[model samples]
Target: MGNFTKWLGAGLGFTLGGPIGAIIGYAIGSVIDSGVSVQEYKSEQDDYKRKTKKRPKVKSSTSGDFEISLLVLASIVIKSDGNIDQRELDFVRSHFIELYGKERANRAFKLFNGVIKNEVSTRQVCIQIREHMSHSSRLQLIHFLFGIAKADEVVTASEEEVIRKIAGYLYINDRDYGSIKAMFYNEADAAYKILEIEKDASIDEIKKAYRRMAKKFHPDRLQDIGEEHLNAAKEKFQSIQNAYEKLKEERNF
Candidate 1:
């Protein structure tokens, strides 16, 4: 609970207030004082931000808020088909443990339970996260959600539509969205899509794209966040490696 309060919805009071705060507040009520009001704190922040020209990148930060946002948005996809699959639960649990230790993960687990039961504005949530999370972090967030969707080995149309709309709201361009989608989706030119290069792209073009993508998803950028996030970034880094390797083998470049 102490760990979560550091960043959960750290700056979301501007637009959202009720259910989200309730879910988080519900999880850490013991740790957080009942008297402290998010609305009151947010009111001050709102007024201060209005007078400032350079606002802090609260949304772009990969702190407590970013992690919480990931799980909340994930809940939307998990409940999209009106059925909860064991595979999805297992996938989320494993990632949760991997990201946060057992103590914190267990405490935060309750938030997810509440999220699935309540109705959330997925579009608004996406907008909030997009405004705060870095470009690479946003890519990884969607990539993990897709993994959840396909955990049962079949991504339903509803799941696809929900994930697609989330990506759009995050301000992710079509090429970037297609690249992430290609990684999970079964497409003939998935390697090209993952590399964000065209099928007929020259070897030099492919090589350049691979390097660019690799730099963008590098794990070092997440080292300041936490070891758990660094591990996740490593996994994404490997994916980019595999995609490039596949192309290199196929093209003999």
Candidate 2:
């Protein structure tokens, strides 16, 4: 009876102790699992950083930068006309802010201020644009710059000269340059020339002359010409239109 009691006690102890041991083992396994998961999370974070650490920088400079630079230069010229008016600065500032956002706009303003203060050379920058950009790009750039300069709704001859010089740097042909100038700067005179009429010509005379010249230079008639020459002719016709518009504006017709 004593032996049997001892055997039963040993069997009970083995069964209950085995379950307690299994619980302890499970707790330890859970702790190890959590530790591994934490290390993996950290390792993933490090890998992400490493992958992005050596990425290349983006270059978003389109023709916009050239436009921005010339606009700044124009601002300097216009401001040099006298005191840099708030209107002019705001016009330029708004343009920069619009193009490059607030951060780059601030930088552009600072750079322009430095130019005005004689801390940097705009001539060199202009040279870079001249060397790198195409003739059409320079024309478009100067046109926009002129727009900004005249945003005060008035353009000085000095400002005009600045644009002309910039165009020269960009290697724009003398003829094309003259054509653009005549279009914007002297549109009325150009129209009078095209129509072979006086500035104060009668309205009937202006109308008659416009009809004759329009018929002669119409783009459809010049279809035989190559695209390049056709483009030139088209520009001429546009100039005529611009001139006529200017004359009408002046006459309030």
- Candidate 1 local lDDT, 49-135, one digit each (tens): 342223333323545555677678788899999899989987887788778877667655645765666667887677766665677
lDDT of each: 0.70, 0.51
Highest lDDT: which candidate? Answer: 1
Assess candidate 1 and give its TM-score to the true structure.
Answer: 0.78
lDDT of 2: 0.51
Q: Write the per-residue lDDT of candidate 2 for residues 1-253, one digit (tens) a residue.
A: 1121122122222111122222212222222223346554344334423333432332222333343445445654665456666777787778667655686566446435533443224455556555544454455455456655676767777777776776766676665565455555544377666455677798877778777756655656533222322444466567667667766777777
Sequence-dependent TM-score of model 2: 0.46
- Residue 130 error for model 1, in Å? 1.9
What's the TM-score of each model vs. the native? 0.78, 0.46
